[model samples]
Target: MIGAGSTVIFHFDIKLSDGSAAESTRVHNKPAKLQMGDGSLSPAFEAELSGMQAGDKKTFTLEPQDAYGMPNPDNIYYVDRSKFSLDAPAQVGMIIGFAMPDGSELPGLVREVVGDSVTIDFNHPLAGQTLTFNVEIVQVIN
Candidate 1:
């Protein structure tokens, strides 16, 4: 059975509320591996796979909060148009990389470009959407 400390290998297909495919491990023939109780997955997701054996296949749906959670209003920001260069104009629906203080880059989606002001959203693109997970357990090492 799958439980804490168990290393599980599984293939998954993620679908959006509209029944469109979002992601799938089976596409590349690469299953995902994760140790139970790890922070890699949300508590709700872990609970859904608490008890299972190899070859078990299940489909479950999760609300927005249980998945990526709702989008935070504070994640939206407005920057001066001058901050963007002519080479990469700030257009709506564009994903731009913003530098962080830790020397890493974060992706923010351009929402709007008003007069001398550009709006960007840093929330996950899938936030606030319901998701369906089709999972097949390939192996479970407890």
Candidate 2:
């Protein structure tokens, strides 16, 4: 059984509320490892893993707040249109990387284009949506 400090390796398939597959670890043949009760996994997510052993499979759904939380309106920012490169003109649904003062890059999705301005959303794409997870526990490192 998985304990609070246990490390778990598993294969997961995540789907949106519409039943559309969002991501799957099986494609890369790489299993994901998570340390329980370390804040690495959400509380609800960890609860689902508790009492599970290797070779076990589980399917569960999470609400927006439980998964990625509701989208934050404050994460939206407007940038000058001139900032976009001609090689890759800004377009709706495009994810652009913006640099931070700390020398790190953050991804923002283009939401809309207006006169001399482009609205970008920095929220995680999966935010504000319900998600379903199908997980197969492969190993318990603990």
Candidate 3:
């Protein structure tokens, strides 16, 4: 059974509330593996997968809070347009990578560009939306 401390290999399809596909692992013929109770998954997500065995298929819906959580207004920031490269001008709906203090890149979506101010939203693209997950468990190591 899949429970705490179990390692699970599964393929999943995620869809938005409008029934639009968001992401799927099977598209690439690759399954995902994760350890139960790992920080990679939220507690609510873990609860949904508890007590299942290999070969079990399940579909579940998660509200915003249980999934990516609601977007925070504070995550929006304004940056100077000059910060963007000429090759990739700041355009609305463009996802840009900003260098972090830790030397890693953080992705931010461009929301608006007016004069020299470019508005960027740092929230996850699916943050405020409910999502449905279709999962097929291929293997489980307890």
lDDT of each: 0.94, 0.93, 0.94
Tens digits of per-residue lDDT for model 3 on 21-119? 999999998999999987888788888889988899999999999998899999999999999889989999999898999999999999999999999
Error of 3 at 15 (Å): 0.9
> Which of 2 and 3 is ahead in lDDT?
3
Worst 10 residues of 3 by lDDT: 37-46
Q: How accurate is candidate 2 locally (lDDT)?
A: 0.93
Report the Cα lDDT for residue 2, model 2: 92
Using all chains and alpha carbons, the TM-scores for the candidates as numbered come to 0.87, 0.92, 0.93
Measured by TM-score, the strongest candidate is 3
Q: Give residue 21's lDDT in candidate 3 (0 to 100).
A: 100
By descending TM-score, how would the candidates be arranged? 3, 2, 1
Candidates 2 and 3, the one with greater TM-score:
3
For residues 43-94, what per-residue lDDT tens digits would candidate 2 score against the true structure?
A: 9989989999999999999998888889999999999999988998899999
Which parts of model 3 are misplaced by more than 4 Å?
none
Model 3 Cα displacement at 120 (Å)?
Answer: 1.1
Per-candidate RMSD, Å? 1.8, 1.4, 1.3
What's the C-alpha lDDT at position 84 in model 3?
A: 83
